[model samples]
Target: MSNGPTKRAADWAETTGFARLDAEAFPDFLPGWVWLVGAGPGAPGLMSLLCYHAMQQCDVVVYDALVNPDILRWVKVGAELEYAGKRGGKPSPTQRDITLRLIELAQAGKRVLRLKGGDPFMFGRGGEECQNLAGAGVPFRIVPGITAGVGGLAYAGMPATHRDTNHSVIFLTGHDASGKMPANVNWPAVAKASPVIVMYMAVKHLGEIAAALIAGGRKADDPVTIVSNASMPHQQVASTTLEQAGAFVAAQEPPTPAIVVVGHASDWRSVLDWYAPALRENPIG
Candidate 1:
């Protein structure tokens, strides 16, 4: 019988009524096929039921750096684990190699799970991988997860959109492949496009980004919230303004893997903050 974390997780699931769900509702993990699954932001509980189902049956799990290690406990025994994460300024496998490996594994008749953090289609290169799989005649399934921008902001008590604040919200990545601000982004237009903007991988170029938005007509005093390691045990939220964001980041040096929100929507955080206290009451190991 399984012991330790896996056993405890199973017990927790059963207690929470997951065990009562119909098993046949989930699709079979067939051999010679691949499943591209999203692991959610950083919290194991945020994972979808389909994602949990895949974890229990895959023959091999190829996961990313952002995937919480706590989630791996649910994997069935004897399954292989492979790390194929890409961290900025670090040596990592090329995207082509990762895609090719998935194809090879499926071709060998192994049930493969290409797991990624957050929604795979949202700036995760999942579309590219799926394109490659389709070209290779490989069958696959896509299971979406809660994206960090929306989910991470909520954990920080900042809503991506407020009925009273914004009618539309924009999502964008801060950096490009060259580790610099994305060159093709229309800063001024983007600034005017929506009332709220959520950025990913933006901490490194926050200063430049803030300057662009300021130049694009956003007020310097506009609210900004930075949530680091969102939904994780070490999560930290820092509030600042567009004018002070650059200095705030440099002075405080909030940890990376953060989500940055710009707009009046962040003001809600002051009133809606809940996760911090919840963590205090029920801490996770």
Candidate 2:
């Protein structure tokens, strides 16, 4: 990795409130090296120090659709910010194309930052990006962030795992690359084993997925909550049972960009709810 900016370090660092961070400890984003970073679940406050520092130094940042645009304000001046964002049921850049762009930028001696929403490894296709980078012999670093499944749930006052609710939590995706229900999943097994179920991108197929879970032995009255626009100022939370979740969430305004949490732990949302008021009064600056 390169030793970072020479003359402008103090100016940018102090201005960004990043000068307090030790550069020696957190090296600058070097030219020709890509950093695959998670922007966390839609909240700038959830951004990690490493990811924030990388944003301050990167020359080109390729980001996903779910990443909050407000976070991009921190990127260094003159750096190219590319929207490589992919939204379900919408036209987006292909994975191969996105990876090739990263390679192209790095080869051109630009500090490439692949900024994704939530933890990149958690069904974010970050692993696929890393594989392509590795095969192309690109030097890169992975920076993890809070996933919507965990962090988003926290924002909605729903814990993924609680001693009374569950010991084992199941983290699964709602769809495959083709945007269909995942074929490999054994719904019955997941229904039987897991105490709490946290799903990503499940809103689209909530009806079918709910039926499968119900058929797999989950109770019809099981508490389920869908957290939409998670961790954002306009975030919304809707609750229903496993039997009615599909129809219940359909009534929600902005539905696709959501996280669905199932099992007993979801009940605590009413008691533990905190972000609702904060989002109303303060919002995130």
Candidate 3:
């Protein structure tokens, strides 16, 4: 029933090292249950082994827009692939419809995998989907994947937390349901909460966000780093300050699906940038 092509079991196993993994260590993908699995930030290689197990067992994969398409090559031979992706400013399936479809699929005794890019609980709406599943009495499990705020930043050589820089880090979203800056966020309090702040889905309102932070007692020249298309081949890293973030972003026009970090942690990127150099040295596969 798969609409997409699937690799031979032996070939895929050899390619992914699936054959060498201990099968008994992984739980069986049961029918009538849903697994909310994270596919990691952007790199297919970042996917967890358990996630790959689910990929091999699931009857259907309901994935997000941010999930790299290359990761889909792991799906089982007969499994179906469903695009339940939701992109900002683009035509997307309604949340209600997507949830309903999951319920419908599980009710039919299919092993369902709700695959998402980044950790599902980290602003990915995995919680809401689980709530709906619980209401419907659909058995479900959560498999946490690497969130972009942490994994993505690491790929850009920016640490979310460094003891010397700060004792705490805050992770927040840039927009609310209406697609504007989140009104409920206490910018002043957040400005003082931690020395490091990692924001997701913030590229659209980078200027306003930087302004609010600056107005809330954060230094205008505070270091900031934006990692776009993180962990992917075309990953981009942009460094700016709270004062010039708006203009810098406007002028440079960096790509979307970016993670914005505000604080001194970005300062370490000068020496920590390993991914870019690694890519450059081995440009050919």
Candidate 4:
């Protein structure tokens, strides 16, 4: 039951031909409230229905660099779409500016949608935006989407965890706020405990990070795979070892928006791999 001019499920179905859902089942996208939504890896099919439903109701969409362009096609025709993405090594909007823009939009009585790639909460700087919104006394909703570490890996035919390969998985970023190796990571301790390690945005210093993992007791030959542009049609994956990951990447020069997975779970890509089920999409092949 909704507070608006509610449309019957049958009427909605008769118009859109989707019989299972009613428009009123969802919370109304009220003006002056912001919704931070995760667009999920790169595949439009991977996006959550809630994210899609919310996008359809937004008055403005402020999206990130990683968000798949295909998903933008679903935004309501009249909605204003704005790009506020920040890509590494590229000139981009400051985070403060982005957050301030959101506040400004909300104050203007617009239903703003902040669409991010993958789960908004997972290293998406979503928490910061939400904090800013809270301080400004603006109401907002958080819509979780599949993270690339999980969903992107799956699309690349790699699992972050497997009973036989790993009992635990660790996800870490390559760079922190400074755009260098993270200052707080206890490399050895993390390397010792994590059987499957997924590294995000680590391409710039893959060599140094790989060396650290090896020095910390990880096997030099431990299988490591890099997945780039994951879940997208142009996705690429590269396989190397802890000792050679940096060199392999340097020689191959795989593109950015990549993640590095270190551990036995990546070995499964040899057998269970199915980036393109019909196409046999192995980057090495």
Candidate 5:
């Protein structure tokens, strides 16, 4: 008969206001539960519709370091904004404390929003927070956003997956809570298996990570791309090799908020860099 899939999608779009949303698509109603939303890498526009909705409706927002401040401006007036950021070498709230705060707020019958940077589940400690909420019997919903591994890499002209170089990609964090190279990571195995590696919050441990990868049989000359403030107007990209990344980054006085990507996919950045065009049109700075 008629195109059933197309018809269904159209109906869904109309029902959810997806087809009619304009620049300001804030929700008019609030759910009687908590929402854990990913704000994407850095660009406020990269935030999902559900995230925007939650911001508009939530009574309080508990956010992380990477969440763009501009996005928070969208929160309704009188909404409480609590900072729960965890920088590598800075004094910040503990993960347990943040989780407990969410539970407390949700229990108070407030529409709680736990806003994070990038995908909540991608090394964002969203799993632990969700587990805590579940244990406290607090109902919650998750809103996925673009992760830095993909969005940040895209800004630097690197793709996580390429048909020619890599069919799969591995995402990992460079350091653990102790601010050291993660001992739990099987570097040798990852070096041998993953053709593409994307790391978040790895700038501080670049030297150790590079050595580990080199020791794991990865080439010292393997391509690498370091992106800082990715997807934002102040974005900077530094291209080098595994052996030189540490020194190269140290030499440059680049701004903070960075991610590191190592693999053949980084080579594709030279030809496929489109973020410049996007940035020229919408300057975040």
Candidate 6:
């Protein structure tokens, strides 16, 4: 019962094949609006067609640090690109400032694309930006892309859900909005409730988090997998146990934008891993 134009367009696309029409055939998108899009984890090929079309049509793109640079290369030449990335313990733009910038661009009669890494709504703070745009009377659309928890795991050859390992999974941020291990998160409760856990932005605090899980009754030998720079050419994955993940990742010094998966599912990486072959064929050195 959604009456929105985007929904209507999607409906038309599904029923009448309007969505299948190539971007080259469509008219330029209207100005004075914003589209918040998820660019997927890091792979350019994983980007949604709608997201790609929006990038081509937008007058401005305000993107995050995690969005793949190769994907941004597709933007129409001469379009403005702004960086509004936020990283843990880094001097990044405030969320309010980024939201207001989107409003300003829309008011300037620009078709704006607020590009984010992974699914914009999933831990990307896209909802707050959308709310700001809505409050300012800016017409907007949300084009969801693959999130890292799912895509990152795939790149590491670990499924988020498996038939024998787990039926229920939990996804949580390693830190709160302030970039610290959330004291509000009852680790004991979560450890008891969820069999599989996927954490974002937790690399810096892995030691504390691992300790908490162990204190909460999770076994010290529980499987842990850290997939860093997921889906990118330089991607790396480190497999260890709850007691050793902190030390293992620290020793390897993997890059940022990583996803951590914990559960029996992490064990599947031993056999399910396929990225090694691909990497061996295309060695960085």
Let me know the TM-score candidate 1 reaches against the reference structure: 0.91
Name the runs in model 5 displaced over 4 angstroms: 1-19, 22-32
- The estimated TM-scores of all candidates read 0.91, 0.90, 0.91, 0.91, 0.88, 0.87
The lDDT values for all models are: 0.89, 0.87, 0.89, 0.87, 0.85, 0.86
Report the C-alpha lDDT of model 2 over 1-285, residue by residue, as the tens digit.
Answer: 667775556555565454545544677689999999998998888989899889888998999999899999989999998999888878999998999999999999999999999999999989998999999889999999999999998988888788887888999999998999998999999888887999999988888898999999999888888889998878888888899887876776446589988887777877988775646565452
Question: What's each prediction's clash count?
Answer: 0, 1, 0, 0, 0, 0
lDDT of 6: 0.86
Name the weakest run of 10 consecutive residues (lDDT summed) in model 4: 276-285
Clashing pairs in model 2? 65-85
Worst 10-residue lDDT window, candidate 6: 276-285
Q: Show pairs that collide, candidate 6.
A: none
Whole-model lDDT, candidate 1?
A: 0.89
lDDT of 3 by residue, 1-285 (tens): 986655554455555544556534689889999999999997887888889999989999999999889899879999999999888899999999999999999999999999999999999999999999999999999999999999888888887888888889999999998789999999999998999999999988989999999889999989888999988878888898899999998999989899999999887888888786567343220
Model 6 per-residue lDDT tens digits across residues 1-285 = 656667546656666443456433544568998998999988887888788889888999999999888888899998999999988777999999999999999999999999999999999999998888899999998899999999888878888899888888899999888778989999998887878999998888888999999999998998888889988778888778999988977897767888988888777888988887556444221
Off by over 4 Å in 3: 1-18, 280-285
Pull out the clashing pairs in model 3. none
Could you give the C-alpha RMSD of every candidate to the true structure, in order shown?
A: 6.4, 5.3, 7.4, 4.7, 4.0, 6.1
Error of 5 at 49 (Å): 0.8
Error of 3 at 133 (Å): 0.1
Please estimate how well model 5 matches the true structure, expressed as its whole-model Cα lDDT: 0.85
Please report, as a residue range, the 10-residue window in candidate 1 with the lowest summed lDDT: 276-285
